[model samples]
Target chain A: MGKVKIKKKETRIDMTAMSDVTVLLLTFFMLTSTFLQKEPVTVITPPSVSEEKVPDSNLLSILVSPEGKVFLEVLGSKDSTMKSETVRADLLKNMVAEYKKTHPSANLAFTNKEMETFSKLNAFGVPITKMKEWLNLEPDLRDKFLESEQNPGIPINMNEDPNNPNEFQMWVRAAYNSMNPELQESMVKGRGIAIKADQTTPYSVVNVVMDNLQTMKMNKFTLMTALKTSED
Target chain B: MAIKSKSRQKKFDTRIDFTPMVDMNMLLITFFMLCTTMIKSQTLQIALPTNEKVEKEQQNKVKQSEAVTIIIDGKIDEKTGLSNPEDGMLYYYEGMPETDRLAQGESNMEQVEFGDKDGLYPAIRGILMKKNEEVVKRIADLKKEWKEMKFSKDEEKNDSIYQEKAKAIRNDSTLKRPVVIIKATPNASYAHVVSVLDEMQINNISRYQIDRINDVDSAMMIMVKAKNEKK
Candidate 1:
């Protein structure tokens, strides 16, 4: 081979198109993202063939762990007249009144700041006695408290008496009463209260929750389940 | 004059690097991926009777000929203390067991495997179809009529007609729909009970109750389990 001089070429590659594509993807994700609510205990709901989607708003979700611990999450209505903040404030007020009726000495009063914080929360399950302390904690400390094993769930005893109900039943009743009349009507028409439970939870645990709801005269409710895959 | 001309002729590079911008975008994408929940869960709607004591007269209202009872049991390993879904079993019977097969010294318990290749659903569906044959046929006819009326644009006329037909089908005294009573053992997982409830929905069953497992049912379950283990 003869010795020949080779031409020099620059190796610079254009990344303008790649950057544009990435920007588009980032914007799409950012716009559509709804952050996952931090649950005290994670549960894998059972799979079923039902196709009805859980309503995005005006919902009271009952979360049940495999250990039978229960938590409550209330998603308020998006309409201007029935905002979540107002509903939550009313619910807290009613709950305090109810609590005081049973335990006259217990101080269930919450400051405006605490009520505001409680309104913004996606899920809550601490007993009424500990709720004041829980609400007063710093945000980071509150997360730690909720995730800790010492966090006793809302007190749910197997009390089937419609007259003297458990704390869980009290919360549910408050939630139902705090809604606007229209929303309450819709709830009676089977448009509210969804139960999300772990697949491995025993039937006894679930039955207790159901019985509690029944005692409150909340006969109609929805059960949240994952979509069943074809292979299953 | 020469220095002024040289100053006027100066040029600058206009190209900008985007590596840092791309890195920032990548970080945001990751954040959103971690925080976002993409799939909305599905829901199964159910209505339960109020928690009140049913009187003896009301309890006797349900006819034995039109009743089906399903039992769910869970088997937990003694060593591991863990429940396996495969170990769960469902037993079902038609009518009252005391007067039926139990009187013949054969437990009326029929085994139903959860999610077997040809499983619990098909068998239950067959029984429901046989029991509700007249009502199902009537509902089908009403649906056909409703569809034709819709196509003919008889909106007001179709509405009342459809409602009347639906009420008749629902209240047909001669049509016998088996009342399903579901009983689960203490160890049986919630998923198994949900599966059976889903079957009722699929079969369009209207009358069903989730009741506690009685002592007799528990004894039958134990007997069935013992016999199966021996086999």
Candidate 2:
């Protein structure tokens, strides 16, 4: 048999199809997802059958830690006209004015630079007295101090009298009276204010917050919850 | 000889190895998938009564026959100071609190368990469903129609119509619907309170409010707990 010898070919796979699929998947993930915001504490909200989605903008979300610390996160109108930064800057100015009304003798003023920094923050809970000091710290240190056990958050308590408001109440008032009229409207309608607390938090801590809101006459609000998988 | 001088043309393979590109894309996809949050948080809306003290006479009194009070209590873990959702107690009473009968170790307040995981609170569900039977019956009928798309050909239109009809049925004052007042003790887990609130929605109840736990309520609870222990 005078036949030519058979040559073996390299078993190389064409990855073009795989590359195409991965690129499509990456595009989908980029388009369909939102980046997670870093918060001082992580909380697993209780599940409920309510299907109402949390509003994207013009919302004032109050985050309650298991230790009873309260933090506030504000969102402005969805459009670029009234960005969160502008609203937050205005809110800080109003808060300064509010703090002075309660403690008129105390001199508290935030510089333009400090206001800018405050506007960039997604959530804040330090006491108004320590706000300037907290703002002055490096970003990493500020976050550490916020999550630390020693940091007393926003000084909340069961104060029913709205005449002599607490720091937390003052913050609420400031947020309500901010430059964004849309936020004020939603706040009045009960859509703007949302309480996000861990499922394990004692009812008393949440009650204090509710009582405080009641005193302010901002009784209508939303409780943020995760969707329950099993619906009745 | 000139014909024999035709040059041999060399061919080159044009296929590209896309392995490197796919590897880079996979790394990016992993990063994005980890960093992104696809599921948005849901919200439950609630409206608490104003804190302003109204004149007792001006207050619209609830009919004792239609009033149902639910109080949520839970066991707190001493070590962590956290309320265990799994180990929870629910006490409910019909009509007004009978403080006079408490001395005789007899009260209208009855204790109920939150139920085990599989049942998903069958006890409380039964009680609430029994209370809102009229509305529940009507809503169930409407839901059947809604499932069949009897309201309209368009799915969205059918849904809106069903929702509107169900809401009307729930708020129908002609039916006997219980006015539930939900109260939670300080030691109760927040989840328990939410679960109770969720029960209100599931029961098709339109009139319910979250009220503060009062002294009379606590006295009754203590009496009932003592009674339960004795039993």
Question: What are the chain B TM-scores of all models?
Answer: 0.71, 0.92
| lDDT digits (tens) for residues A1-232 of candidate 1 | 9989897885665667778988999999989998898887788887777888988888889998766778888877777788877888888888988877778898667999999999888788899889989999998899888777788788897887878878998898888788566557657866688889887777777888987888788889989888875322
Task: Give the CAPRI rating of model 1.
Answer: medium
lDDT of each: 0.78, 0.90
What is every candidate's C-alpha DockQ against the true complex, given to 2 decimals?
A: 0.57, 0.84
Can you list the residue pairs that collide in candidate 2? none
C-alpha displacement of B188 in model 1, angstroms?
Answer: 1.2
lDDT of 2 by residue, A44-129 (tens): 99888888999999999999997799999999999998999999999999998998887999879889999999999999999998
Which stretches of candidate 2 lie above 4 Å from their native place? A1-7, B1-12, B52-60
Contacts from the true interface found in each model, as a fraction, amount to: 0.73, 0.89
Query: How does model 2 score on DockQ?
Result: 0.84
Candidate 1 local Cα displacement, residue A191, angstroms: 2.7
List candidate 1 segments past 4 Å from native. A1-10, A229-232, B1-13, B52-59, B76-83, B99-105, B117-176
lDDT of 2 by residue, B71-110 (tens): 9998888888777777789999988888888888888999
